[model samples]
Target chain A: MEELMDILQEFEPGVDFEHCTDLIDGKILNSLEILSLVAEIEDVFDITIPTVEIVPDNFNSAQAMWNMICRLQEEE
Target chain B: MTSYCSFPFLFLFLPAVIVVYQLMPEKKRPYVLLAASYLFFWLISGTLLVFLLFTTVSIYSIGKRLDREGEKRDALLKTAPRDEKKAIRQLCQKKQRRWLALGIFLQLGILLTIKYSGFFVENMNQLLKWQQIEPLIKVPQFVMPIGISFYTLQAFSYLTDVYRGVTKAEPKLSRLALYMSFFPGLMEGPICRYRDMAEQLSAGGKITYHQLTYGVQRILYGMIKKVVIADRLNPLVQELFDSGTAYDGGLMFVALFAFTCQEYMEFSGTMDVVIGTAQIFGIKMQENFERPFFSRTISEFWRRWHITLGTWFKDYIFYPVSMAGPMKKLTKNTRKSLGSYYSPLLAGTVALFCVWSLNGLWHGAGWNYIGFGMFHFMLIVLGNFVEPPVAWAAEKIGLNRDSVPWRIFQMLRTAFLVGMGEVIFRASSLHQGVQMLKTMLTSFTLGSVKNGTLFTLGIDRHDFLITGVALFLVLAVSILQERGIKIRDYIAGRKTPVRWMIYYSAVLFVVVFGAYGNGYLPIDPIYAGF
Candidate 1:
């Protein structure tokens, strides 16, 4: 979870990823930024984020993203 | 069948379907909808209903096969060793891909051949002529089956979803057909995903008094939008756009703004009617618009307008392209040098390019549509590219990006940019669009608008007055919606006399002022052609 927050911070410098649940819904991270975040998370965590998992529910918050990464890891 | 506003559709066909639907047994209501949808398809496209049938069968069968492969893979995974599980999964994945590929080819092949064959052949012939060879290929003209473009995308989405395990394979054929051919969505669409409409189909809820009245109210609102505003703007828009007269800058700007207004009122109005019709049947359809004019940026504008199509491109094309293996590599390679902000852009721009090119072509087999797509593509890319600088400049100047004044300025700027794209969309050709923009920019004189220039097009001051009033009514409604106040609920809560009076007044307003009767040169529901 801390690792996920760190990655979100790198993509959007000042966003409160720790508290911002609307990161996806509020358009804080637009599509391209989401792409960058996805790639970085995959590298740091060693998990593949499939296109199906790229929905708002999985990326709307740091916790949501952490949940998705954990799930992908479990699947692997 | 001419349009939703046509007497036959409003008076005869729709009411008949509703009556029959209500009379049918609860469990059988969905089938009644299926029959009515097929009948509507038959009325418009005749034997071409076969195309819809073909796709319905294709998705059902392929989906089941994909599901079977999933089952086989899961079963094997439970028994196999960890190392062997990977191999088993790959083997099943190969089979699923083959089936999915076949489904895509079969579906898109028909759309490509019927919709784009003429454009391809004509362009090819021109290429051949340029090479000093006699052009010999004849362009084939095919009448596109109504809703083919819309349903094909829905069909594609369903198949892709099943393959991705986003949605399960729909075992029933009728339910799938109803999804593809729902009469309200048949001609143009909000492009429902199977999951979105699946529950509504199976539920077959009864149309209550509230649903009926509210549904009619929604339909009436749509009627006013289409007839009072869009239809009234039609001739003036057509003349300004298609008439070869080189009008002054005032008229050109009118042409620019007028077509955008007409397209919005017509398309969104159609959605109102479609959604309202769904409401009458106690099935809630997704909204295709959300006050697009209120948007503060080109990207935000697309998210609001023709919303389903925009999201369709985003989900199916944009994300896939961005996440494709090549793009993944591109993003990784760029990150080290360009840093976080700029790295993903290189890959994203590629995805945007594909989306826009296909989006433009999807509207029609014309270069102007492609230009319209690229026009927006450039705007969005430029917006992304300049964001950091713009933010820096804003902070330096003490401008609040989220303040009312700043937001208004952004909205107006976005509207101006969107209006120009509308001109390109409505132009006869890409060359014409460029010429119109050139003339609009170069020949500026506001005095021409006041000198009786407006009266000469096709409509008079009376027509202008009615459209203005109608537009304001829509604007008031939009403003309320944007503020999160539901006008329908407000009206619904009013006293019976007040509600009925408002309802009667609305009906009379449409009946008395609508631009429909004879001599009105059949108002084409604009997006239906696309």
Candidate 2:
């Protein structure tokens, strides 16, 4: 989780990714930020996220994103 | 059959549809609507109704198959051992993916074959001639079925939404078909999403007095905009845009601005009719325009204008393409090489390119249309690039970026950008667009207007005055709406006499000033062709 926060901060500094559950829905994490976050998550966790998995429900919060990473990793 | 704004549609078709629709049982109202919608499509598209039916059947079948596969997968995953679950899910996904791909390919294939084959063939033949090879391919002429671009996108959205588990496949094929061919939106659309519209379409309701009055008022309001403003500007726009070299730069600029206004009024006016017509049926379609001219940026303007199409592209195309594996990898590599600020923009830029290119091509299969897309793309990209530096500079200069004057300045700048793009859009060809631009830059003179050169165009001075008054009324209403005052609701709150006075006057204005009858040719809804 610390590692995830670090990656999130590195991608978009000053954003409280740990708390902002509406990151995607609120437009806090825009399309570009989401792309950057996805790239970082994939590299950090070594999981290939299918395109369908890249939805707001899966990436709107840090916890949601972390859960998706874990699930994809376990599948792999 | 004329457009929705025509007397025939207002007096004949719509009244007939409404009376029939109202008399039907609530459950069977959808069938009435479906029949009316098909008749509407058939009237406009003639034999091209086959294409709409083909789309409806194909998408419905694909959606059902996808739903079935999804259900089977979920059921199996529930019973399978934890260790085998991932494999089973993947297998199911792979199969479902093929179906989704097939659905998309077939729809896009049909769209491209009918809409773009001539352009493709012509360009290919041009290339062949350029390379000193014999140009053999003859461009095939096809009368594209009306609203194919719109309905296809709506259908594609449904299929993809179901596949992504965003929404379940609509079980009833008739319901899905009605959603696809909903008459109000069948021609030019606000482009309803399945999730937004499907249930509303299926659940028919009795029209309340409020719905009926509000719907008629809205339709009348749209008619005023279409007839009083847009249609009046048509001949001048045609004259100026067509004969670019013959006009002075001042007139050219006037023509360009006129075209912009004409397009907005016509397109948004048509949307008002569509949304209002839907409202009378107690089915509230999404709004397409929200006073786009009031936007402070090209991007914001896009958000306000043709709003659904923009959202559709953003949701379906931009998001997917940006988050795809290749784009993710590209973002990573760019971040490593070019640093953070620049790298974040890379994925967005690529996705934007796709969106804009498709957006431009979606408008029409012409170079000018593509140029229209590229024009906005370049502006947006440039805006993104310079934003930080511009912000820093503004801060350094103690400029209040949020001040009213600055906001107004930004709005004008955005309008100027949009106007230039519209110039390209309105031009007969790209070469003509360039010529228009050149003439505008070179031959500009304010004296032309003072010397009554404007009168030499189609509209007389008295006609101009009427158009001016109508435009001002529109502008005033737009301002009020922009400030969060609901003009319709406010009027609805008044006493019956006052409300009736407003309604009667509105009707009177449209009747007196409308550009119809003997001399004027009806301007088809501009976006309907697309």
Candidate 3:
């Protein structure tokens, strides 16, 4: 989760990831930033991401994304 | 008077519909909205209603097929053997894929033939004739259907979304129809998406008094922007560009600046009207502009101006190109060869090129538009390159981004950049654009103003006054908006007498000041040509 926050800092500096649940909803992360974040998340967590779950709602917020990462790790 | 939005229709047709709609049962509201929308389209577009109907039925049916195929494919993938599942999925998807392609191709084909055939044919004829050969093609005149480009794009986006499983296919035919031809968004679009607007279309949500009042006030703001600032700026812009030989550098530059403001106020103001109208029906449409003139760079200019189109390009074109196999491999290869820093830049440039070129082409089919795209691409990429330097310069100058003068300077700089782009955009041809550019650099003067150059463009004192008043209204309204004030709240707080008076006064002003009577050519809504 901390690593995820670091990656998001690239989108807009000084973002408080803890406060954001509507990342996608609020358009805080554009599509390109999302792609970059996905790559970083995959590398950081050493987990593969399926393309099927790349919908906007799943990544709209930091919490939603954190939960998604947790779920994938549990499955592993 | 012939415009569906004219006095008689507003005073009679719209009010009657509203009265009857409210009197009717709530369950039948969707049907009523559909009827009213189609009737508006039919009345305004006449026989072009057939085109709207055709699009509605074809897209509606195509959505149904795509949804079924998606369901079948998902089911097969879960249970069948890998080979069998793959084969079954491909077979099921093929027809659906073709149907979607056919729908988009047909829509674009119709748009091109109607909108671009004359220009295409004329250029071909000129080229052949210059070679002393008999011209193979002759240009034909075609009356383009109003709102065809906008609605076609909207329908295509909706269908494309459903096909991709980004959103579900809307099941109800009438609801789909309403979504496509919803009166406010039909003529010029913020390009509403199915996933974004579907729920609003199906259900007429509860409207707060605040919303009702703010909606009407916003409409007033939009009307003033259109009638005053935009219409006023049109004449000088036309004259200077139409005969560039007559103006010196200073006047031409001013003309260009004025045109930029005119275009922004005109288009964005129209959007405000569209959003306001939707708000009246408790529908929340996407906002299309956000004080784009205040952008510090060309990239920010795009983000702030015509924002929906920018997002559409990013989502539909840029993302796909950046992530697609070839581009992905290029990014990977760059990383392998040049390292990570170079990879993102390489990918970003390719993505930017695709998006910007498409953006340029989306404005119109011309070399000038292509140039317009390249020009902005250069600025944005260059802005990126100079980011560190610009930051250092700002720090050295003790300039804060939040400072009033800095903000104003950015706005002025953006105005200059955008104004030059409009010169090319509004020019008749590349040669004319070049000629205008040259004249802007060389033959400049304030003498033309003293010699009645302004009057010769066709605007008079009345036009200037209306423009001035309209601009004041727009600025006042925008200030309120910036302060987080919604116009509806103010109107909602007012007594019924005050509210009704405001509405009636707006109607009167639009009727009187709007450029619709004799001696005025009804300019087709500009984006419709796209």
Q: Each model's TM-score?
A: 0.97, 0.94, 0.86
Docking class of 2: medium
lDDT of 2 by residue, B458-504 (tens): 88898899999999999999999989999999999999999999999
Task: Point out the worst 10-residue segment of candidate 2 chain B by lDDT.
Answer: B335-344
Instruction: Give lDDT tens digits, candidate 3, residues B1-530.
Output: 24323455446765665566666666677677788888878777789888888888888988888898888778877887755864775687686788788878877787778777886788788899899898478678787667887787788788878877788988888888999888777777888888888888777555456666677667666766666567657767777777765677777776777677777877887787778767767789998998776677787788888888887777677766677666665665555465444455566778899888867877777878878888788877777666667788989998897788888887788778787788878787766776777788787777767776665676776777787777777677677877789766677678989988988887788768886566564334456566
Residue B421: error of model 2 in Å? 0.8
Q: What lDDT does the true structure give each of the candidates?
A: 0.89, 0.88, 0.73
Q: Who wins the lDDT comparison?
A: 1
Candidate 2 has an lDDT of 0.88
**Model no. 3, DockQ:** 0.25
Candidate numbers sorted by lDDT from highest down:
1, 2, 3
Those runs of model 3 whose alpha carbons end farther than 4 Å from true positions after fitting are A1-3, A9-13, A24-32, A42-56, A66-76, B1-5, B77-99, B117-135, B204-212, B333-342, B392-402, B450-456, B461-466, B490-523
Compare the candidates by DockQ and give the number of the best one: 1
Judging by TM-score against the true structure, name the best candidate.
1
